[model samples]
Target: MFRSVLVANRGEIACRIFRTARRMGLRTIAVYSEADANALHVREADEAVLIGPAPARESYLDQARVLTAAKATGAEAIHPGYGFLSENAEFAEAVMAAGLTWIGAPPASIRAMGLKDAAKSLMVEAGVPVTPGYMGKDQSPERLKAEADAIGYPVLIKAVAGGGGKGMRRVDEASAFLDALASCQREAASSFGDDRVLIEKYILSPRHIEVQVFGDAHGEVVHLFERDCSLQRRHQKVIEEAPAPGMDEATRQAVTAAAVRAARAVNYVGAGTIEFIADGTEGLRADRIWFMEMNTRLQVEHPVTEMITGQDLVEWQLRVAAGEPLPLKQDQLSIAGWAMEARLYAEDPANGFLPSIGRLDHFVLPDDIRVDTGVEAGGEVSQFYDPMIAKLIVHEETREAAAQALADACADIEVWPVRTNAGFLVRCLEHQRFAAGDVDTGLIGAEEAALTDARPSDAVIQDASDLLWRSRNVDPNDVWDAEYGAPGFRLNAARVTRQTFFVDGVRHQAPYENNHPVVRYGPQIDGGFVVFHGGDAYAVSRHAPRGAGGGGASDGSLRAPMPGKIVAAPARSGDAVTKGQPIVVLEAMKMEHALVAPFDGVVGEIGVSVGDQVAADAVLAVVASTS
Candidate 1:
């Protein structure tokens, strides 16, 4: 094995690779951007290097800086964990050419599987079933439209180089195909620098099932069972589990066999995943599953695979990179128990799942089970990268038990100020259809309202007064605290010491009394305490809106929800606007959030001009009600 290894990625995946590298007695080097100077991965590395500034392109994706860092730290190998340059075939070749072991798929294999169109063609040649679609060189809109029409309605327009739900669109009718195709192509070009797209027959009930295939230098490959990534939001995976809920032995064998074939077709080595899209209208069947694309690096949800198989996949990667034989034969692996993982992100589901960035003042996660993260309390979730905070994973003998246990764990999360989708995850886990093995990609969108309900219950809000009262009157050092109705003690509320506060800018009041424990909240900060309950943060403050509010109020004001640059201001001060009409585009965290009109009104103000930088709550534009 290589003496030292440098991880050319950031966040949880980088930290995860380091854990295994340390266990294998290898020196670990980490590269960080300016924003990630205090990041957990940098702090935990044996040696760290400053690659560039906060932006990813200047740091994580900077090939020259990464190579220089590795050479300086005497790192014998480079591990591109996932994302960023993980799938960049040229980067892989550069690492190899620089005489460093690239602990990932070879450049040849990466190139072979880089484009979805090419990969599908290879899969077909390898006798692996592929989705019925068009993957031709014709870039004309007419050809794409013709392909869509032939494939029937509800065709999937996918960018050849897309991942993480980007550059993808589903058209349910012929009329929308052209528009969807145009949008998909534009995103693909902007995101991957490749506008080429392929059309596929959209599955009515699609379930993402992928097999973990590891190949060794000895030309041997083995499968580590399969994972069901059907539970998704906006094409991004929300929850993933091992031993797909409805998978039978026959289907597993067929899928795993095809996965091995897919890997072997490209002479693939190291850790790779063969993603298959299954039509789960009925239970999983071999005939219903087809190859989608291949992920040529370790996956974020690899923990669940480890929990079930009792194998260290990172170690496998290290050995393979060192030109070792397969760790175990195909027959040696067996699925043990059900494992489920939920990606906990710093985002507000109710508000279009926009990224939430701020200091994690009171971030706390459950101790039991497995929790993987690269951020901690007191750390700032900067608007320079992805906002995934952690991954909550659980393993149980039964799938039912795993889902419930993971749901409870999600409910136990306590974060303040910065909002999250923890409550949404809980609902997803406990959803009747989800619990019954009726999983699909449309589950989140179909049940978005119930899942993303951000409102705190009447009882929870009623108990907020108790939290505020304790924050003011109760002493932390007092061991002899009053219990419910114990010697002049009162439960819920004894005296109506009315306390007024605005939660998310809306005002509410409740009687002050001791309602211990049910309503948990962080200590007083920025005017008032933030109620942390059921994995949701309700910003409660005694003060009301000051002047022209910006932090996204129900008013017709369009504000920079977070610190960002104004990209476009389409609506003028005198322009008439309707509710939800796009007025301003605020760019932050590598995402563009459209600040839309809150209600039907006339545009009364345009606060920020294009190319202007603004603060978290800075007003961008405003649309006043006609009344």
Candidate 2:
């Protein structure tokens, strides 16, 4: 085994790898950006090094800086923990050239599967069932239009070079294809530096299932079962579970076999994931499943697989990277239980899932479940990176039990200051269709409103009111005439204090009690400040609200959701735009966001041009009210 390994990444994933490395008796080195100087990963590592500035391009993405960190730290191997430069073949090659072991797939394997168009072509040739689409090298607009026409409407335009739903668009009709193609191309260029795209038949209601595979240097490969990642939004997975629900023995065998084949075809080593889009409309079937893509590094949702497999995937990656043979064959691997993982993101799900940035004051996950997180309380969530807070994972003997457990755990999770999708995740898990195992990629989108619509019960509102009354004075026994000296409170001997505070979009009138030594609103609010108001009270620390500016809002225009560069503005001043019409496309955290017209009107002013970096709530444009 390698004596030491350098992790070329930051956040929870780096910490995750370090834990396994330490357990396996290997020294671990952690590299971090300036933003992550005091991050958990750095504190957990045996050694730490500063890479560069906060921006990924200047730091984590800097290959030379990572190599220098590895060399200076005296690490024998480098582990690219997902994201940043994990899948970049150039970085993998550089690691090997630096005379250090690359704790991941071979550089050649990464290169082979780096490009989506190229990977799909290879999979098709290898006899893996690929989605029927145009995967040709032709980049002509006319040719793509022709392919879309030939394949019929509702085609998908995907970037050839990157994944994570970046540079991807779904057009339901042929009339919308051209505009979507240009938009996708621009997003592709902005995100991956590659504008090349490929048209594919858009699969409706597909369940994303990926099988994890591991290989060793000695050519021994084995499958580690599969994970169901059907719940998603904007093509990004929100929830994932292992031992896919309702999967039969035959289909399981076929999917696992195809995944193994894909792994061996690339002469892959270490850990990799073979994603397949399964037809959920008619339920899952071996024949209806098609190859999606192969993630050449440890996946973000690997915890679910670990929960079910009872094995450390990171440890295996280290062993394989150290030129060890497979520890067990495929036959030895068996799913022990159902495990579900919910990605907790710092974003507003109701407001088009816009990323939110702030200090996490109250960060608490359930003790009963396993939570893999990168951020801690008081940590600032910057706008420069992905707004993921943590991942909550739970394991149970049955799928129903696991789903319920996850829902309960999510409800118990208290994260304040930054809005999260925890409530949304709980609703999804409790959703009837999801509970029944009838899920698809469109599940979240289809039930977007209900999933995000979090409302405090009457009991909760009552509890808040009681808390408000009690917090009026430091001395609970103070009379109504007595000075109720406290912030957000005043001595109101003549009248009840009425305040309007939002809880899960529900406006509540919390009438403070005028005289009450014993505070009570909700039955459970006897001792604490409103027992379940929104997320968690301990998680609620007040901070200055983000300033709203940007765009042109003289007549009240909707602003940009978060900080990002304007990649596309199809509308200009005086152009008529209807509600929901695409006005501007903002690229942030390596994801494209479409700012649609709030109401039917003519574009009064366009404040930003392409390539403009905007701050959160910065108005990009204003629309004159047509009504």
Candidate 3:
């Protein structure tokens, strides 16, 4: 084993890697940018080094800085913990060149599977089934259009060098081809610095199934079963499970064999994932599955596989990088139990799932399950990185039990000031279709309204109101005395005491009799109170009365919903736009949000330009009534 290893990443993955390294008695080093100076990963490492500024390009993605930090810290190996430089073939080669062990697949393997088009061609040549698509090099717009026409409508335009759904668009018809292509290209160039893309036939009723494969220096490879990651939103996985719900013995053997073949084709070493897309319109079978792509590093959802197989993937990575043979042969590995993982992100489902950035005033998770988190109570979710707060994983004897436990765990989370999809996740897990395992990639989209429309029950709302009233009126110094009125006399009065609050932007007034029993409240943090009742918790903030001079902007103003950079301003000043027409596109938290006009009107004073960063609620443009 190596004496020490440096984690060339940030957040939960960094912390996760450190845990395994420390358990193995290996010293761990962490590298951080200015934004993550006080981050949990930095505080947990044995030694830490500041690399560069907050932006990834200046820090995490900078190969020279990372290599220097590793060398300075005397780290014998560097673990690229997914994302950033994890899949960069050049970075891997550079690490090897510096005489430092790279705890990832060989650079040759990474290069082989780096580009989508080239990787598909390689898979085809290797006799592995691949999705039928256009992998040509022609960059002409006409050529792409012709390819799209040949592939038929409802084709997917994917960036040649893209992952995490950044540079992907689905075109339903020829009329939308050019526009979708432009948007896909723009995002691809911005994300991967490669605007080139390929057209693929979009699979309807698609189910994403990926097999976890590991290889060693001795040309030995084995499989760790599979994970069903069909629950997705915007092409990004939201929930994942091991031992796919509907997978049978015959299909499993076929897919696992194919995955091993794919790994051997590249002479792959270390941890990698072979993702396959299945046609679930009928049911999971051997014939309907085709190779989609391969992730050349540890996956975000590897924990589910870990829970079912009773193994640490990071440990495997370290052992293999040290030139050790395979830990176990293919026949030795087997699934134990069912496991599920839900990615908890700091995003608001009510607001089109826009990313929320703020201090985590009250970060708490259920104690019953395993939670891999990056931020704590006082940590900040910044705009410079991914908004995922944590990954909640649960295991049980059965899939239904695991799903229910995961949903309950999500609902039990108490995070304040930073909006999350916790409630939405609960809804998804509890949905009838999801519970029955009748799911696919389009599940979330098909039931989006129900999944995102979860609201607190009336009893929970009343509990919050009661807690707020007691906190405001009851004196902590003297429990017997009431600040508003005498306890006995107030109870005799007929009028009710009204307490106002804003629960998710909607104003609510709770009227209660003075004699009403005081409801118990949890610890108060940052002037906000968390109320618990009926086995549920609600975080409510007192809505202070608007002071004088509050009335300001008109209702027709199109404001930036959150702090972000203006990527495009399609409607200029004096340009006429219809209701719901997009005025500007804002980029934040690595996603695009389009701000649209509130009503049919003419565009007035455009306050922001392309490439300008604006604060939350800052008016980007005003839509004056046409009448």
The numbered model that scores best in TM-score is 3
Tell me how many clashing residue pairs each candidate has: 0, 7, 0
Q: Give the per-residue lDDT of model 3 (tens digit) for 221-245.
A: 9999999999999899999999898
Candidate 1 regions with alpha-carbon error over 4 angstroms: 174-179, 472-501, 512-516, 542-557, 564-578, 583-587, 599-627
The local distance difference test score of each candidate is 0.86, 0.80, 0.86
Model 2 residue runs over 4 Å out of place are: 473-507, 510-554
lDDT of 2 by residue, 1-627 (tens): 779988888887887888888888888888888988878888888889998998889999899999988888888999999888889888888999989998888888998998888898889888899988887878899999999999987888888886888788888888899998998898788667789998888888788999999999898889999999989887888999999887899999999999989998999999999999888878889999999889999999999999999988988888888887877887888889899999988887766687888887667777767888778888878888888878889999999999988888877766655778877887898899999888998888888888877655556565555565555444434344343323334456544345554443234675555433221222222223223433423211112123323334445485877777888888889898888888888888777788877778899778999989898879788888788
lDDT of 1 at 512: 48
> Where does model 3 exceed 4 Å of error?
472-502, 509-554
Ranking by TM-score: 3, 1, 2
Tens digit per residue, CA lDDT, model 1, 1-627:
788999999989888999999999999999999999999999899999999999888899999999999989899999999889999999998899999999999888998998999999889999999999999999899999998899898889888998878778889998878766766775676567898899999998899999999998888989999999999986889999998988889889999999999999999899999999998887798999999999998899999999999999999999999999988998898989999999999998988999999899888999998999999998888898888989999999999999999999998999866788899999899899999999998888899999999798886787675665565675422334453123333456443245577776778877644555566766676777777677777777767746426435477666677887776676788998888777887777755577878788899868788789899877777788886
